[model samples]
Target chain A: METNNRINVERVEHKTSEKMKKTNFILTAILLICLPFLLVKNPVWAQKKESSLQLSFLKKADQSKNILLTVKARNEAGKFAPAPNASLSIFIKSNEEWLLIKTLISDLGGKASMKLADDLPMDNEKYFSIMAKIENDSRYEDAEEELRVKESRLTLLLDPTDTNRILTATVTQTGNDGEPMPVQEAEVKFYVERLFGKMPVGEEFVVATDAAGKATYALPKNIPSSDTLGNLTIVAVIENNETFGTVESNASAKWGVPLQWEKDPFPRALWEPRAPPAMILFFAIVFGGIWLTYFFVIFQLIKVHSETKIK
Target chain B: MKTTKTITPLIACSLLLFAFVHQTDVWKAPESAKAKKNPVAITEASMAIGAKLYVKECLSCHGKKGRGDGPKASDIEKPVTDLSIAKTQAQTDGELFWKISEGRKPMPANKKIFSEEQLWQLVNYIRSFDKTIVKSK
Candidate 1:
């Protein structure tokens, strides 16, 4: 009886120990799984300030492949301040992979600018992506910004259409074969550079590019010119565009009326030399058409009368 | 050397399986990807833009009806999921956007090509096939 009791007790103890061992093993496994989280220095309460990067393309004149990246970090004052001496890794996307172009430390103003003599090899060969990244910072978390810009040109052409001036904005992007391809359905805005600010040229705020990548607006008459020669700077811009950033081309045209012209007026019944000559031509055309019609009708009536008499 | 019949059949089966595996892969989007909401509004203008972009960029593999039966669908290695199917429609806009932006083999990541709003516009366009499925956020 003593032996049986002892055996039973040992069995029970062994079972309990097995269960405890399993429990301990599971608890240890759980701790091991969460060990990385616990060991990490940047916890939820002690996280660093987040950094932000902004990228922009600065196309020189009507052509050039130049890009500028801006990096900022939220300072103690909770404002975006220039992240000086920050390492910025610039990458271009090609073949669905990020090709690191260069790593340039940002200047004091947080501007990292670079000019590419040739276009980067893009996936589609037309549109390209430039990504800027600032990683592994001590005081700030990692940040990345990407800008997708299509290789394009904005041409501003000022032409005289009859007595009025027509401003044409053409947007062209590089095709697969490295030829100029017209971009359709691109929204373009026309602006006249005024002394105070930029004055929108057409009545409509935005005009979409046609199949030929052209948007034309007839310059309104009597716009005040900056100088006596009636020359004003007209700018064609594709502002805040997804494919094309704020691309603008300026051209000088004699579309605006000189201040002297605006003041002089006609001096005689408010009709000038140019207006009377054009007005005389207009009236002459109307009278000439009317007389011709009347003469034709009378001639037809006389012929009908003669024919009836003969019959 | 194996028997002629067994060897030929085994070789053929291996090639077939290889092709099948490559063509039929369906990757799952992460939880963060599923939680994304469509930022582009579902309006006539937005849908129109989406339609135009779809025709230009996604028409090759997705097909005219988004049925994954496009002309190039067979040529592509990855299985083109039918965009109009209920399985696809049940997914959130962000999930679709994530899949498009971060593609696998034979499917290029479109984030390099399109902007954020433009990808949302594509999601809106894809949603047009079945209007009843998507609940706008």
Candidate 2:
């Protein structure tokens, strides 16, 4: 009896252990499927969203004057959310050395503003660098903004209908968005090439954008036609020493209009002057010859009749 | 006698001019009238030949139903031309024969493979696609 009880106990224990093992296996499978979803739903991942940074500066600044450095940060919602304690740095080159001009944390409005002292002697041109950084443990959420001072960019759009003509030009002061910002007073100088082996020269024409951010210029009447039209270099000079905005934008387009011809049975020259005159002349000559022959036969017939009657 | 001779020559010249103009105008009228009288007739034998030829050659590129989606069409860079469109089916028999004999781009010429009589049969089969013929029958 004791042996039989012990065998029964061992059987029950083995069944319980097997049941537990099966339950654990099911739980593990469920967890494996839900693991990715759980990590994505974590709260910390939601707070550290991506941000975009913009940088701008004037074209020229006084040597003793400080350059105003503005940095704006926008979250994924496109709202201006304050990033308190976010680090910002501005670097300007002085005597060929990159010196950190200012360092500050973002304000309540997600913006950092500082005045950068001119490190090098002021000339007609100056160069500077600005950067803003946001720290996050997540590799994907970190953001940085950098600035580079180089040649200004120009974009020209010829209306599709105005194929060969330069309908208008747009000179924009490009910022971080790679687009021109609104300018109240901007001057664009237009130039054209000389025709008939004459030297190419610049013809200055000033155009300003209206309330609707567009500048219109009528192309010159004597636009030169050539096998290859060279590039049109438009130089935009803003009155006063405004250094932060784009100083010039340049663009060029090819020189001829696309011609679409209708299908015709005859060659171009066939229907012009050749056929009508020849047709008229042939009819006139034939009629004149017939008339002359009829008169001659009539005169001969009357003379013969008169002669036969007298005989 | 002199007056009669003068009138006869004038009458002859007028007759010659009138005959020349009239003959030139009517030169191609007979053939055109004959073609109009005998429009293409689609018979079962011609359609059967067309079906056989299509299965042997065209069905590999243009699908069995002429939807332009056959098995070999998947590998080709340019899609096969669909023949079910009314514009294609409305093409004249002569135009169809020319296109088939010369072969358009991407479609190889079948002139050497198909005899003239076989091509005419194919033209008859294509004409069956016209809705007017079915309605009239």
Candidate 3:
């Protein structure tokens, strides 16, 4: 009876060991299958932590001085992620040229602030563009904005009666509702195409418009003449207290008297004589010398022939 | 007689040269008279329309205040634009109108969505940033 009991106990122990082995194998297989998925998902997790960067500008209350540029950066999770080593650049246009005013790094709060020079002369009469840049990993991404400087409205009139006539130009600024806005001082620039060995010249006239928002300027003496004369373009520019206080307006009219094909008489002399006084004197001297020499020679010949006949 | 022959030819050559130079100085019209017309004005009504449109389309990239920090700006590889600079305010109405109509790369043209008048209104709203016109009060 004791020998039978020992054999039975051994068989039960063997069955238990086999079940433990099978359980271990299944767990190992499941881990192998899911390993790649977790590894692949790692980058997506990192992306969520690395994607927050923002930039903005702060306008001063008075709006008279330099403007403050605020650049904010955060992680993909929208948390403030300070990029202490990150580089920042700010550019501005001054005197018709683009100038890099400052470069720095963001602070601990993931923010960078810069002050742009307000005294910089901005010609609002023309179009202006600005750009800022920051490094993102291995690449550089930049933000850019192009704008037209605001200037007052400018009106130019061309006289249709006379070719040599001068048309007056008037400039003023209007409010948001088209009402006359008060402008301390504004510049009205006059320009025309260059023709007949003349380049289009620009003249700047600075004047404060009256309560009526009107400032008048006399046109330059030599206006460009074109065969297809239409409205001559005039530009008015004003840079006020605001960083973006640049505005411009244009007005044109028919230039010179319209010429009829039949009645349009071409000038008898297209070009004014450019001969120097010295050149005229030189020609007169040469011709007079030749005439005197011929007369003298003829007189001598006649005298000699008459003397020979008398002899 | 010999002097007359030389002087006459010299005078004729000079006259020819003068005539040629004078003719070259005459003004001629350009081949085509296609001049770019003035851009439309930006009005307050257009700004109202642009503001509504901004919420619908641009608010995703450009924030509620036209700042480049919109919700989607963070995900894109490119940095968003900042619209509050003096340099930006310095731009002409025409230039701003052109850019909005024919957007720059990365920023698709809004022309497909907005009419020309709406675009002009947007420009006007942008110009409202001028301190003299857009007071905080």
Candidate 4:
């Protein structure tokens, strides 16, 4: 009975080994069949599981625009991995000129992002493009990608009601035929136009446009106007709208109290604290020069008189 | 009535000839000015400068190769003068300089725009397109 049991156990082990060999052969054949298709690459997805420049996201804030670039490479497993330590150059095309804005190195995650300042030069066209390039990479080939964004327009109109002043902002973008098309659900902000910068119109920083691309707000009556005519320049602006980047339109309305700029009752005398610095400097320089000349002449006369005594 | 018919054709022909002569023949340089000598020496450097200045200042109306077929040539009602032909090349260097300096209605005067040396260089560039320039070289 013991001998019979041992033979049965050996037969079971042999059958299991044969089954494992067949399974391994099938998996190997399948991999070989699919090898050519995997090696044949599509450029969009071609990280070589090597390297690629990807525009991961664009963020336009109310007052600033941010552009993000993610550099990726293929790992040993043919999986996408961040290409760290890669150098990147960012360029913005304003009209016909390609201006280099920033050069950066990719972080460990193969990502680099830059915020375009409000003062970046822009043309009057409806669209602007940003390009990123990775050159002379030791491990991966060169990669470049350009992203173009259509700028949107914002215009504000003021209508005076019986008691309340109504201001409306409309947002639009250029369509295929280059005609204005409404950009619905866009956020806009209103500001009281000031000499140096802008003051927010209402308590809330931003207001959203309706389906018709219009956002309306009521103006407070107490806002002071710089001119005597009580005319206030109300500016409606869109900051960093994903589509429109930044645009503003302003209209003047006679809706505020006339602000009288007070002039000093007496003109500031020279050497006074409120006197113009330049004027005080000019007087000091002239008087100092005159006194210096007088002293020089007196010193020369004294020397001549002494010399005459010696003679 | 027959005399009127004959006179109409004769009047039309006379008007046409008068307009043609007014455009081509009326640009006579003063005798003393025509004899003025070009002070700019003829050299490769001058030729290169003349070529550059012509492209910037004159190429819009005068066309490349001085064929008077520039992109802006048609915008003017008056015909652009071809500089390559004998009609223009026959003029002396000083005469060409004066004509360029004192441009007519379709052409603005370059006297304020270009210096005397630059005008002479442009005159040399225009002469470069002439067939005689090739023979002289």
**lDDT per residue (tens digit) for residues B13-98 in model 2:** 99999999888643122333224322435678778897767767776666544545445654555555556557677655666766
Q: What lDDT does model 2 reach?
A: 0.54
Docking class of 1: incorrect
| Ranking of all candidate structures by their TM-score, best first | 1, 4, 3, 2
TM-score of 4: 0.32
Considering every candidate listed, which one attains the maximal lDDT?
A: 1
Which candidate order results from sorting by lDDT in descending order?
1, 4, 3, 2
* CA shift of B8, model 1, Å: 93
Q: Model 3 chain A, poorest ten-residue lDDT window?
A: A59-68
Q: All candidates' TM-scores?
A: 0.46, 0.26, 0.31, 0.32
Clashing pairs in 1: none
Q: For residues A114-134, could you state the per-residue lDDT of candidate 4 as single tens digits? A: 877755554465567888988
| Poorest 10 consecutive residues by lDDT, candidate 4 chain B | B67-76
Evaluated at residue A163, the lDDT of candidate 1 is: 69
Candidate 3's residue-wise lDDT over A115-200, tens digit each?
Answer: 54554444544323344556354222343333333333445455556555454445445455646555544443344433433232
RMSD of 2: 37.7
Model 3's DockQ score: 0.02
Task: Give candidate 3's error at residue A190 in angstroms.
Answer: 37
Residue-level lDDT tens digits of model 1 in B23-136 = 775578999999988878889998988888888788767765675645466556555667776888888888999998997777789999999998999998998766355444
Task: Determine the backbone clash count of candidate 3.
Answer: 19
Please give the distance, in angstroms, between residue A206's alpha carbon in candidate 3 and its true position after superposition.
29
